[model samples]
Target: MSEQAKENPILEVESVHVAYGRVQAVRDVSFSVPEGGLIALVGANGAGKSSVLAAVSGLVRPGSGRIRLEGKDITRWPAHKRVGAGLVLVPEGRQILGTLTVAENLRLGAHRRRRQAAPESEMYELFPVLAERRALPASALSGGEQQMLAIARAMIARPRVVLLDEPSMGLAPKMVDEVFAVIERIRASGVTVVLVEQNARRALRAADTGHVLETGAIAHSGPAAHLLKDPRVVKAYLGVE
Candidate 1:
């Protein structure tokens, strides 16, 4: 960890375990994100990457371990409470309302704190295409456009830490590039980011730090640049050259 990171992390996931019914999806996963840092969590399917994000967003309760934000423990905080505390998740599949207009979907994201919500203009600036289709149903937008809306909606909450799950899933190569660019801009704007991505190469390239999850457990972790060059990581996750 760097001197700046040691000062105080923005988000901490400590030995968390998440289970559903008879199945344990995540086992003793732990990682930390420093303020304004971008941390990439990369793994194959069923590696429990999304489960960790769900636990952090309060969508799923951890069977054990702790989650903290800004030095305070938030392990038991409800989803709404966590959102109010500046933790937000832009879930996979761009879960924007299909029937609602683009503007309506963005408004819903800030419904919890309407008075303090970021102005729509800010969202528009980040995603100008959304501005052009404000009155159209969210379903009408292209895959990339809907992804942009999902991110814009989350941004309206003014999150201090954003958990982004599979932001590049099912998009064209060009669209994927656009999404990664936006993520970079988001990080540059000072929001700590925990990105769970299947694109290990891109994720590692973009992240300040990288963590690899295998079968719900952390298999490796270190500086993103180092992970990108690691022989084991490259062969197992980043693809053989």
Candidate 2:
């Protein structure tokens, strides 16, 4: 590990195990994100990608092991507390309130720390279509627009680390490209990102490092560029010849 990594890990998951009743969803999964780095967690459905994000965001408790943010233990923190502490999760499926106007839904994201929220102008700049539809109900937005809104809402909270789950799911190919571009911009803006996606090729391309999870355990972990070219990764996840 580099000295810079040691000095500034924005998030750390150490031997995390997560479960629901008798069923375990994640087993001994571990990774770390350096400040301002983008880490991609890629796997098929039921590989426990979302479970890890849920645990990091405090939406679910780990049965064992520790979760730390900037080196402080946050394993027992509540979801709202985690958000306030600069860890936010943009869950799969743009869960914007259907009845609320786009602006209203976005304001709700800042409920934890209104004073620290990013300005609406910043979000508008990222997704210009959103600015034009700010007054419309969130349900009225197209699939890609709703996804953009979900990302914008998370950004409004000014989180230090964003756990993004399946941002490209259910989008057209063009929309997926657009979303990936926005994700790149998000990383450029200096926020650490942990992206969980089944879109392995795109996710690995966008990330600084990549981890491959299989059946709740980390199967492979390394630099994103190397993973992209790895024969096993390309054959199993990237669908390359």
Candidate 3:
């Protein structure tokens, strides 16, 4: 990471508003994901968490305000173009290609994108299970394995920032834990992550900074550890005793 990349955020959404026709989904929302760390957005259902991801990755256009990547405004950028610019999204569902084998999916992720000069031995190193199942058709894998493949496919693209939407959804408790462990490893490997999750407890635990969304706006944000300990956060989301 350059000095600018280190000091400057990888992605910044400033005072953005997005709507579906006239039904506003996000209103004047703003947040920043620092380069090379995990920043999570946590909220109740329909709090506009997914909309935020859509706006950032250019799936939805913002009515007002700007989206910046590395200090450059990219609100006008298109989705596929954003992928070339090093922004990628692992959407809510594990959208793996069922007919493709694991290795094929990974190779396709790197399609039209430059491979990392130094191989990501770390990825296979991190998830030894993926290597073991590399030849299986995606549909043959378990739910947890499919989720892992989705994340691994994204990683192979070598994106500078990734937007992850509801990664823990539909996962059993054990699978959820395993998926989160992979997310932590992704952050550790120098990729900035923007995580949108309804599982506030685990999201806050894994994030460096956390944003709490309510009804399409950023209701609260701060350091993860501090927010994790906040009384209101504990009561509403953490279920502290």
Which ranges of candidate 1 are over 4 A from the true structure?
Answer: 1-5
Q: Write the per-residue lDDT of candidate 1 for residues 1-241, one digit (tens) a residue.
A: 4687757898999999999988989999988889999999999999999999999999999999999999889999999999998999999998999899999999998885676689988999998899999999999999999999999999998899999999999999999999999999999999899999999999999999999999999999999999999999999998864
What are the TM-scores, per candidate, against the unseen true structure? 0.97, 0.97, 0.92
lDDT of each: 0.93, 0.92, 0.86
User: Model 2: which residue pairs collide?
Assistant: none
Q: Can you write out model 2's per-residue Cα lDDT over 146-207, one digit (the tens) per residue? A: 99999999999999999999999999999999999999999998989999999898899899
The Cα error of candidate 3 at residue 42, in Å, is 0.3
Number of the top lDDT candidate: 1
Candidate 3, 112-182: lDDT as tens digits: 36644124454567677788888899999988888888888888888889889998899899999999999
Q: Provide the lowest-lDDT 10-residue window in model 1.
A: 1-10
RMSD for each model, in Å, please? 1.4, 1.5, 2.2
Query: Which runs of model 3 end up more than 4 angstroms from their true locations?
Result: 1-7, 115-122
